[model samples]
Target: MLRTLLLGLVTLAASLVAPAAAAEPVAEPGAATTQNPISSSFSDTYADPAVLRGKDGWWYMYATSDPLHEAPSEFGLMHIARTRDFADWEYLGTVFDEADRPAWTTGSSFYWAPDIRYVDGRYVMYYTVTDTVAEPGPWNFAIGVVTAPTPAGPWTDSGGPVVAPRPTGNGDYFNTIDPALLAAPDGKRYLYFGGFHGGLWVTELDESGLRAVGSPTQVAIGDRYEGSFVVERDGWYYLTASSANCCAGPVTGYSVYAGRSKSPLGPFVDHEGVSLLDSRVGGTQVLAQNGNRWIGVGHHAIVSDVSGQDFIVYHAIDRNDAWLDAPGGVNERPTLIDRLDWIDGWPVARAGAGPSDTPQPAPTTSSSLGIVSDDPAAGEALRAVAGSWDAGTDDDGDAGAVGRLVPADGADDAAVRTEASAPREPRVEADVRVPTGGRVAVEVADSGPSGVSVTVDDAARTLTVEATLGPRTVSDTAPLPSRFDAGEWTSLAVEVRTGRATARLAESRLGDADAVVGVDLPNGLARPRPIQLTVSGGEAQVDNLTVVAAHQPVTERVAEPVPGDEVFAEEFDGDLDTGWSWLRPSSSVTVGEGVLRWPLESVDVVGAANTGPLLLRTPPEGDWMAETKLDLDLGSGTVRNYQQAGMIVRVDDDNLLRLGDVAIWGTRQVEFGKELDENGALRWGAHLGGPVAETMWLRIMHTIDPATGEHRYRSASSRDGVSWRWGATWTLPAHTEPSIGLYAGGGATPATVAAFDWFRLYEVR
Candidate 1:
């Protein structure tokens, strides 16, 4: 299927450019400048976008576009767009065109989806062509091929159509478009294609790339339209496509849909058990429309920018005023772009609305930044150096006898504090140890009525403070001077003389001759503080309250579980235990929770589990139900596989019932069958691939009628002591039993540890 699809679209090897009008930059509002759409002025349409991140730090976006809006063109052109930031797009021109017109597609009027790839130093563009007027036949379209040296090309076609329309009886006879090429990790090339009027199909292509190596397989099918694109991430192949009505503006719309499969060819299924084509948002809707305020979104392409930011580009009708009308109505729709973020491996658009136009303080980018400190308590004060203070006027009054502190980024309500008095006790101390060649900037915010000078390392570094009645933020930058001496610690002390204040340290960017020293904030201050911090913006916070002392400790106890009498226990000496009678039910007991839990052992004994069938005075008749929970230890202290443990329902002795294990053969395989051996012991079989180790839980359910001689069985298992997979149902000859008991057998290797919680039998209506 891949080879056939690839052949159809790779015949043309020439590059052609569309004569598009030059785009003019529009003057946008301030908000628009920061949050403008990536493909702001380009006329774009989404088919299936083939995205590739080139080694040159550019993302190449190639997709099919309608050459002349509504008019039919001979072939589709592969449009290319490049970008670094998902928010900004750069048009890279068309990489494939039908100017030379390959013989097979010359008369065809439409090019559907074009997938592009850069392989072996050459560019390959795969595209599908549709003929509005069929060549006097039922099948009306074909997939063609084109190629180029660079993404932008000038000439060459593959001579003819690589993949033609299928035979009349084939399922994909209506159309063979929307081709998605995937270069599997194992060096194999696979192609997935199909669209509206047909289901998704897959086939392999030989290394030569001229034909399909195997029969094309129908992977998914439905009544609605479907387009396919394959992307591999983290070893998982994701098949994403658009569903429902696309391309008819807002009123006539569509939405994107996706699913995953381990193989290139798939039994693709959505969350619901429906084919991708028939899968719609609810009923008739296609792609959901999304934009600033508009809906009706469809035709999407997912690409990653130069900076490795993923983005989704799609066309949406901006119908804020006009109603979405069909049958040739005038509606202007434009292409929009939004950042795509991966949440739990799925694409989400425009996830976080980060800061757009808000100005931030310019980061320090110098080599030799230092700190100045003077402590009045240490008897050192009023010291000024030449390059320490800027000669700018303090318009906000945050300047002391020295220069004023400039608010770099329009800080609100900024003020300067100048307090001259006896030095107060240091509220907090920090050891300032700078990394070899880095500088640190410390920021402080004042939350008090007045401003006070803060001392660092007994050195009085004047911090101009701004105080607002509510909340005011003030900041200061301090550069660390020298490299740290190994095994040596430096201390920084902060003390306030008159007013109360709190400070915090932010971040530290790492570098060489430009390293940053971390500052630690002291504890017990009224404000939030940093304990040990790095240079980027690490600082300690202090409040008006004084430090308090420490106190003592206490102890407490919780709850526990109580054990009951052992109704049945096997010491594992290869012998059957006593006090256990597995019985067949007539009007009592049933498997409700998959596995039966002996209620006698549970806190809510009667409510959660059941206990009976001890001494059967009469043989119960009619249909019966039985189940048991088996706990097995596989390995890694967890259950692995094939650990059979459940109930033997309708047992004449032990040879006529069933058993079930949830986790079988590494995969969950449910089993239900009749016992073949006549040792009065039933031999039920489960074909799970491996051994069972750690604790695994299993449950078995059976319904049988003694008079009618009819019986049915079901089984299930769990790993975490909860949850079970009910196996396929089975039936057998009915039997009578005056006595029945839960039976558990150890595996061939006898799982080092095995146990059964409980068992029960009942009759269902």
Candidate 2:
């Protein structure tokens, strides 16, 4: 009751001083942030974002480090960039990109997605690294850490992984990547990680915060969720994770999903009351490709500015780059920033054509002194210190609002204090004036089973660290280093450690410790906790107080493994082939012995663009050689440009390579071309002369060049299934997968037929 009433006073005072009007938003603030992509580098391929605003007035961006085709250990450990305004940026190259990599970190590639926190004046980062992605059962990821004096390295890797996958690998734990750290209300640091196969999970970190202290709890298992960051606001923990395949160029299905929970390790459900354990469903859609060319955009970081407005920074693929289809352009995901809206208790990001091309509000820059001279700060509420305390003027000429203890009669022990919202590694200092017989103390209590109180007793001329956390209360005291002249103000501070407290009091700023004393409170007080200020004995006044926490960055996210692949073959028999399946809906297919007949309706191999009859199979290892005999039945109609059927190498509806018989501009010929987009616009390779007959043998060969490493595809036409005439050779995008099948599409007739005598696939020598 005392704590409640004492806190009420601070709340009331803060409320009175706060702004009364709704302030203008930063969005179109005549002086808003900058443009889309926020970057102009032709080589800016950023992903797996990690962001931090330093004291230096600049925001630094870090993400999954890419080696950019360089040899291992070539680029830095992680990609780094910086900007004063969110618009233009300067890429700072990589961090930890040393000569031989670090001996402590064992990985075959660049450090994957990483997140960083500023703890104890240094930046600590968590990242994933691994040796090889060969087997499923073997643990695939090892999350490591590195510390630096600044956000921009010279980072010294701890030389060890803090979170590693279970040695048993992909079973009870399908993944041990994408870690999100949080400092919860329980006064503990927690780490959240995992995805799809095993479900997302959470675990507690020890005080050092370099390793896990407990078993992990599974939180959610969506259809496919990864790359998540968790943020805490108003007692609720919000998790924003990416769902679906996020890397496929223009046709990617990646979107952001959100869910909230009362506890960090949650039985979290979405806005619909559905459990996170469910499959493929969104907790709540945070953002998606609502159209206009922004492709796959996921992996985000949420940053709250000093003015208290929240902004999200992430990576989104630009359609302009998506159209490149070769080299680094196809997947050149650039960083994006935009303001976030909080409606009710949740966050909503309204991005029209998100990964939006329009300019967004810049993060309201935080003042160096933390005072928002403009208007009331959203969360900078002045808290009332609880207990039986009265407001009064101090003997020292100070008059605004000073707390005075009101004891019961002459019994003393009365106090006034506020608490840190959660259990955090804390350090607090304050200037205080103690009456002749008084004591001013700061107490860190669990409020239930344990607590510690560090007091500066002027009457006793000593400093005491009294803690009651473990099984009993113990006192550790030290004589005053020098006279803290009574009647005048003195500076005192207390530092909270794992189950212990250290108090320092002196006449002036204690340059170095003359004496150090401490006592263990309780074993359970392992987490540095919220501390309270209390005054006992004579009147005591506390002012110019400051508090600091060491674990602020644990709330950031991230992970990736060598994606698993499905490889095998399919041979059509009397029954439907197992490996071969129709993609969505298109022409009808009837399978029989040595034959698969495609009856076209108003359909094409490329659903919206390329003209071809659709059929598909999983690409197995080694080179692929597909040969087939086709009898094209174009019906009695004038065949047009796309009127042809042959071999289809499809990546998706938007991209594919169709080569074979094609009617180009009123001419009938076996044309080799690539339908680069769903628009049916083909990058014509060449016209392989005119067609011989309706029945011809066709073969498409796909192989990876050992030298240049580019995928090579060749098409050949044959008569009598023996003598062959080869067509032009073509190259497909280096970063996509293709499934081979016989296809037919054209503007000639609504109805067409493609009959195959036999479709054979082989592993090329």
Candidate 3:
């Protein structure tokens, strides 16, 4: 799967005369700078990228380039870029050129697969520079080693290929390329490398890291693969590699696959126990074509940040922006970066999809949350659609300011539309403030069969639903109590449900009131229409205005649930009774007071698709019942949305049963049902929520109707941690098999404490 990388067209006319480019500019989180292929002023053609943060604090990135790129005959082979932040990058120069070629090999033109290592005092780089065209297929390339005092090298080569291609045991095939090294628990270094038509090879290397000690051991897999990268986490060795045609522009079917082994070498299999060699069968798919806008997504490097969060840096040819069609870009391999989360025993990016278009959490370089400014122009959340806003200002009026909207005497400039919300209705929210006689109102057009315009005006304290041009059939009105306070901020929201509309207002979460009326917006305005805001005079400042498809309001009451026939149950006396295994370790997990005390991190179990949580697994499945009583103690921090912990049923990472608290700002809501990340790297679930209790009994039941061969899942919770009242049951897609587990997570402040009294599993008798 070797194809030419696109980034080698430009060569600085100046060689060793000047050092590679360097700089220090950082972009705030969620800024456009974090977008895929990120921002690089240096090179658009960068590919086969290998990034390392140098001792100087600048991230130095090296990559392969077309040997044809015009440069000094003595110029280095790999292209380089350096940056203080990951977003803005400055292009550096080559690592080696023709004049710096290894002695054993004649002058070479082709160079790719560059890897860097900073050990002891000097820097070591292993790269593929061998011209294998003279040999047969199955990739007959070898790697060479070079050393220099710094990542920005004034180099010296090992004089020859440190690892070269040789005949296999069958004496028929051989492979040698894409070298990567692992510094194992032992004092020795293990070199991992290979390519298409060749099995991955792992060999022991001396501390020098340039020479192999003995013959290499070929790691077993099903088929040919390349770009071998091995990393060890939690005593597990994960080998990730790229397979198939990695480059061919839009049609390229390249993808990344991974498998884990206790030992660094030898056999590795996917979740299905199928050999990675048989990728067609299964091999923990890491990233595949996102299909929305990106393609040819493969040949990646997995590296971790200071926060221990992993990132997958790779090159992909954009569908609309392919480099081959661009000037001087004969190949179109553009580099991209995405966060990678280790789930179960494998790594998964957003939805296991190749590259996501959805905005991701800002790159986690540090453990703390990176907060961007709230100024509308600088705010990341409000970047989608800048409603007709002229300018903004604050007390300083220097820069960071909220967007100011003023209605013209007679013009449509005061209103603008954004993405429309659906299913039930749109959740429109924004933090607004008015001076003296000013007002801000939001209006949505409903083009549905039975729709009308719904407007909420705080200044007038009026909640109105009217039909602009219709038979004037549906209508309703409600008074907003103390809706607006001059010169003060207001949290405004409108939940437009079919046949009914509810408007909620609050200064904070406290002192909140809702105004509900049986009035529907014109169904004819099915799409997002300009939110009509009419200002007679005065001016208003708007900020934190966000529009999302919010969950429906919960209206369930606490009560004892009806119990079903019992099957099997566990009441902990001392330790975790046999069947339970700690799938993931936490800081402290102890059993006492007839409970399993679990303190979850600030991360929660959102859509059960991308696995990560404090999970305790049990081997039980099918038409079964798993019930547990959980008592959540705030410890030091309060629960927030995507926080709180509870019981879950799992088949794997992508498909699972989750029954837990989905909180926002310490307000608790219980969400129950099967959750999956099947929709555009986002969680797509058909679930419902109810009030949450600190001490509640959670139950998940999977049932089957033997006659019709139908399977369904039901969930319920009780305030007493005993009896539970079940909700509407939902059937999962056919092949879903679920195992029971207890999960607690909330990657946030103060941490979380959840203690489980006992867990019991039962099958209908």
Candidate 4:
């Protein structure tokens, strides 16, 4: 009651400050702050953050529903806050009160992931309704909208869902939540929504901005992306989404990734040309925890300062103080702000520096920033080689000039070559229509005899990358999404960097796609060469054809195993050691021949059951690392509703971390899972990594956050035991002795045994 009263007083005080009539033409920039987490003015968890510059000149921020403080009765109904400078914020309570929530929403329903936008002269906010009064269970998620005269006001709910609860082709329904609005320049409004259950999708909204109008198009694949946000820069549409687990107490691996396309609705692809829908999954990392005080950096909003510099406003967990009160309680994610930079046509948080922990300059608040292009225009420094190519106007009904190349009666290829030498690492792009039955090709890093050629077969709707050596040619083909229309102007691109070449076919003028489908070339280009564009068998008009130096390689950095002193080792050659204990002892587990064989169980430790037995053992006195070699193969490309076996670190059934090679759906992955109790409810969070082998090595490194003495554990796995893949880290409470162990389960699969070669613990170096 005290907390509620304090919040009411604060809201009333904030309301006294009148809105600015108009933004200043040249506003003064805010003073630099000493460090990040610019929203540190507020101490509560503010997850799934969204920011909108109000007409009154202040930037209003909204977050998912949660209690403002430790008081359970003081829940916030989608909290709201505002700020003049991006650093210090003023909490203005929440958007809804107990009596003002949507009528369709039940008392237990939680509002989440709010997206605020001003369209058609009014403020429109779209949010997620976790469960409605009419429908319940299995995640009956829907998108709800509300409108108000101003950023803060007496808003009116639209009465019902803009996006009704939807079902996937499978028996289960899609997790339709996380709605983001993009008020396009062409008087069209597109809403990007959905979550881990249904993937990310985009649908056009009616003029009223309250209902969906057209069929929705899937953007990112399920189990990979959520919290979809779209922003346009230099004519390219970037789709940024959060990945991994959002809530796992201290172990949440939530991070942000991005992909871009030319069209508002697209077949978006990452920097390496990987499609978001591909099973291998593709995302250029935007923000991630870089071994700092912060973790789970994701679900962000991008805003700009008056000076045009961009800033990413998101939430992150401080390793030292990860939870509200109890170890397994609600995660304490606070809003943070950092500079967002664009590198070579791609957006990276802090110029790929990851999260910040030091003093930084703040954003200027007086005006608005717009997108600016740094890339040079295309079709320059090029000359026709095979056919008479002439400059033409608007070939495909679009308002733009195009280079038209019509091959003669029997000509095979109408080619154009760049007069200037191409860079050693070059990216070539062209916007051209696929002649009814012919093909369009872009060749990069080409010498006289050898080069990489990317061809798009319009008839087959396939993108192929072929490497040509004196007499040898290697190629790989991937089918394009049906949305890539041959009748429309398609953007084709090929980027050659390092030792591989990537080919992409975009619905826009040019872009990237599925990285897994890209092909490896021979030693890259030894010398500078010329790029070429070819049209075969028919006449095609090309626009925006350019070749420029590609950016430095963008790849995932594998975590190196920390060296330490050996403390404990179990070979499994003898009967159970006295150090090991089991939560629910199972007779199916055996020990012999230097191995421990545990058959997959039909139990789980998540949710309410908590019945899966875990083999338990304590570690050394201080920070330590645990290593284990497991020979468990759940098979490849098969549905095994999950059979897994690996190492685990636990404080109990409710709060623990598990890393195992498990088969989920059709994908075999290395899963890092966290199970915790949130406000008396079981909450499970997980993130996945891949390339599992029949025999693999898994390790967990544990340390303590010096500031708060919280226990931190990081996960790593290796297919060959030589190179390790480090995953996100999770945390435990201070001074607590959580046991480290091994377990395997997640029913519905054929019998399989998890063979353990050894278990070892070592003191931190």
TM-score top scorer: 4
- Each model's TM-score, in the order given? 0.39, 0.49, 0.44, 0.58
Residue by residue across 1-765, what tens digits does model 4's lDDT show? 000112122110000111122211122365445256665677467777888765344568888886665445376788888887676779888899988889987776678888887554457899988767666464577899998876776689999999988866565568788898875434467899987776889999886879999799998777777888888765688999888767655556677888898887888987767677765466676776655678778888887553335678888888667666522246677888876767678777755556767666666553111101111123345667887667777633432556677786678778877677777776665556777778888877677778888887778767789988778777888876544555565556577777777765543210123111467776644356776778886877776454555544223222244747888889999887899998998788899899999988889887788778789998876678899999986775466787888998898888888999887665566777777775576756665654467899998888777787888777777777786655666667786779999988887358888999999998766
Off by over 4 Å in 3: 4-33, 67-76, 132-140, 167-173, 277-281, 323-329, 351-353, 358-361, 364-765
Candidate 3: residue 160 lDDT (0-100)? 65
Q: 238-321, model 1: which lDDT tens digit per residue? A: 666654344322223344555656666765544333333222211111123321233334455555321123455554444332
Candidate 4, clashing residue pairs?
A: 34-359, 251-730, 273-513, 273-514, 274-513, 274-514, 274-515, 275-513, 275-514, 491-509
lDDT of 2 by residue, 1-765 (tens): 000012111000000011122222335447656565664452355666777764334568787754332122233456777876666677787776556476755444346677776443346787765432432433355567787766677778675667765654324334566666665435466777765445577888776667887788878762246777887664567877765444544444455667888888887776655456543232555655433345456677777553334666777666455422223222456667655556446565532123455655566443222322222111232233434554455443322244455555656666544433423556565556676777777776555656777777778877788777556878888765332345554546566654456665532221112234666555666454455666777666654454544212211110101112223333456775677776664536777776767665444654444344466776665567777777875432243445677777877765666766654433344545454553543322232322335687776667765655555565666556765544334455667777877676565465667677777776554
RMSD of 2: 21.3
How would you order the candidates by lDDT, starting with the best?
4, 2, 3, 1
Most lDDT-accurate candidate? 4
Estimate the Cα RMSD of every predicted model relative to the unseen true structure: 23.3, 21.3, 24.4, 13.6
Output the TM-score of candidate 3. Answer: 0.44
Worst 10-residue stretch by lDDT in candidate 2? 10-19
Better of 3 and 4 by TM-score: 4
Give candidate 2 regions above 4 Å deviation.
Answer: 1-30, 41-43, 67-76, 132-139, 167-173, 323-330, 351-353, 366-765
CA-RMSD of model 4? 13.6
